[model samples]
Target: MEKFFHFVSQTGFSNIEVSSLVMLVIGLFLLYLGIAKKYEPLLLVPIGFGILLVNFPLSPLMVQPENGQPGGLLYYLYMGIELGIYPPLIFMGVGALTDFSPLISNPKTLLLGAAAQIGIFGTFLSMLMLGFTDLEAASIGIIGGADGPTAIYLSSQMAPHLLGAVSVAAYSYMALVPIIQPPIMRLLTTKDERRIVMEELRETTRRERILFPVIGILVTGLFLPESLPLLGMLMLGNLFRECGVVDRLSKAAQNELNNIVVIFLGLTVGAKCTASHFLTFETILILVFGLVAFAIGTATGVLMGKVMCKATGGKVNPLIGAAGVSAVPMSARVCQAVGQKENPSNFLLMFAMGPNVGGVIGSAIAAGIFLAVL
Candidate 1:
């Protein structure tokens, strides 16, 4: 009995405690949100499961070995996240799936994307005042960009220890955009503004479509080399799609490659949520800052849209500006839904896509700026 007890104590299971149990419950809640609520399931489900696995008492999945070296599945998974491999791979898939024509047709929408980034910078300054170092605060601020991959990529580089909290915060707010953004959207715009109608988008030329990805690569590469891993891969995927010669490659990048990377990325991110790392005063602070970042981003986008609306004599729906957060089609969809609520005939989706894609590029640039400056 004594020998058996000693052996058990040497393993991870013996270390199971109340904190671990709490983490397990949190993981299950995340899983429930993903599976039942359909809240960012592609990432949340895997990450939720990973959280459960890592938090299970003495699970070897997250503990260090007797030799004092890191041990378990999570350790290995974390390597990919730490090295910053998963996000760029995900970007390649995003590039393949994204259509640039909507953006090209309404290039002026790029300003909304730029304006939305004000939240990221704003949050950075706020976090610094709250006592986080420049780099750590910058990572926290990026939650406003509303781009999960970019948030993860920048956090991995700038403040790796905060990865679990920052990533969870970024993705959670993204999933809640419909909830969080609508109230702000309604508050910021008048009913008449929401009901405004715009002309249909003009058809984009094939040459323009073909030229976009190339220009994106050159401009991003020249201006922000640090962004190339993401921008380059993203643009490459777009080129494959627009070139019209690599249907197989485009399909593979969008479907197979995307699905696989998301799984790895989600699981690895969840692994970072070990109880010791997650249950802290700092974690709570990070969550608070994340919400602020997102709110500011939404408000900035909407305000910019209002400005554009006045500038364009109501031709631009300020609500479409809120879609600039790079939550991709989701933000755009929210803009469409809200617009339809005010005016059933109003279709803002195509116009929203301009800032939607621009938001992606904007977040990447923001990440690069953080890397360069902070």
Candidate 2:
């Protein structure tokens, strides 16, 4: 009977505290969001499971081995993130799946993507003003990029201590792109701007498509070698898709490679949300700053879109500018939704894809700049 009580005491229930319970609840909520609401199920599901696993007391899956015991699975999986392997591979998958023809068709939308990065720098400066170290500021600012993998990669490099907060903030904002970006976009753009219809994208030549990936690597890598690991793999994957001879390899990258990396990346990132590291005033500040960055990114994209609209003599729809956030298809869809509300025939998805794809490159370039300068 005494041994039974001892065994029971050794389990998670006895070690669970308010903070652990809170993390568990947060994990459960993420699961509910992923499973019920279908909010970024690929991201939230594995991450939610990680949170649930780590919050349990003495969970061997998340902890280091002690007394000759084997370390937890997460402890090992985390090395991929810490060593910066996952983000580039994820980018590779992104490249494999992405269609860059829209961006090639309208190069001007690249400006909108670049404009969106103002949020990243803006938040960086703001965090500095708030007394965060330079590295911490850089990591936190990246949350505004709306690129979860990039956020995790940079945070793992610069501020591993703040990894959990910044990563969660990045992914949460990404998942909430639909809810968060529309209001900001609406507040910044007029009904006329939203209703503006865009000209159909010019068809990009197959040769242009084939050359883009190679040229992209040369230009970006020449300027920002630190970005090569990411940009190289991204372009490599895109080249696979465009090369006309590697369909099987491209499909594998898009499906198997991407899925595997996502599971590992999400679980590893979620494991960082340990109660001891996550529950703090600093974490709260990071969250607020991240939201500010996301808002600023959206606002800047729309405002830039408005400028392009006038510059193009109404040829450009300002609505597509909001897709400049690196939330990929989601941000583009938000643009479509908002535009449709104003003009039902304004099919902005193709137009928005230009900035959507450019935003991915823009954020990666920003990460490289941060890495180079600081």
Candidate 3:
């Protein structure tokens, strides 16, 4: 009877609290969303599982070493994030995979990308008014840019205490981009604006592609050296792809290296969402503000598209402007989907890619500015 009692006490059922139970349910819901609904499965799946793994009562996964006891496996893995390693590596892979030709061919779209940063700064000021410290506000505000890796990097640097909440909020909004962005795109643009077709982009030469990353790095290095860690890796990866001389390195960065880093990054991010870290009042506020920032970003992007449409004598489709958030190809695809719904003849994917890729760069620069000034 004594042994039996001891064994029962050792089980999770004995140690589970209300908070643990709540976190577990949240984890399961995330899993369902990822596996069943296919909403950013690559991101949500690992993150969801990490939430489950960490929520178990007396779970050793995140336990720190003490009194000669070794720490949990995830404790070691999470250091990559704590030390600001994974996000930049992920950016390198993104660079390897990105085709900047769209932005290069149409440099004007870069302004639409810059316009989206208003959400980041806007949220920053709002959070400050709400009483969050500059660091915390900066971290939370970054969620507006809709770039997970940049958010992770900045939050990890600026507000390590808020990392779990900031990371989850950034990624959650990113995953929800498809559901969240369409209405804003539709509300901002008229039927005629949605139906407008862009002229096909001119072919970009190999030399231009090759020169871009180099020039980009030099200019950024001179102006905003703080951004180099993320932007530098991004441009380097793009260089590897464009230079056409290091197929092996480029492929490795794009495929194997990128995949490995994402798994680690996702699981660690999820692991950070333990009940204590994630269930606070601040966490709730972060989530709410994050959604607002994203909505504002989407709205602003489409408004810019509208302005450009008028400026271009109706040559531009306002739908593509919504892709200015750094959610990568997903937001661009949403623009494509919404435009096609209005006019089956419209093909906005390639055109939207201009602002989409530009957003990635713009968000990185925004992060850099935060790091530099604050």
Give lDDT per model, in order: 0.89, 0.92, 0.93
> In terms of lDDT, which candidate is strongest?
3
Q: Candidate 1 — which residues are off by over 4 angstroms?
A: 1-14, 63-71
> 48-77, model 3: which lDDT tens digit per residue?
999999999999999999999999989999
Stretch of 10 with least lDDT, candidate 2:
57-66
Local accuracy of candidate 2 as per-residue lDDT tens digits, 345-371 = 889999999999989998999999999
- Model 3 earns a TM-score of 0.98
RMSD of 1: 1.9
Candidate 3, which ten residues in sequence have the lowest lDDT sum?
110-119
Ranking by lDDT: 3, 2, 1
| Shift in Å, residue 349, candidate 3 | 0.3
Residue-wise lDDT of candidate 1 within 86-171, one digit each (tens)? 99989999999999887899898889998888889999999889899999998999999999999999999999989999999999
Q: lDDT (0-100) at residue 152 of candidate 3?
A: 96
* Candidates 2 and 3 compared by lDDT, better number: 3
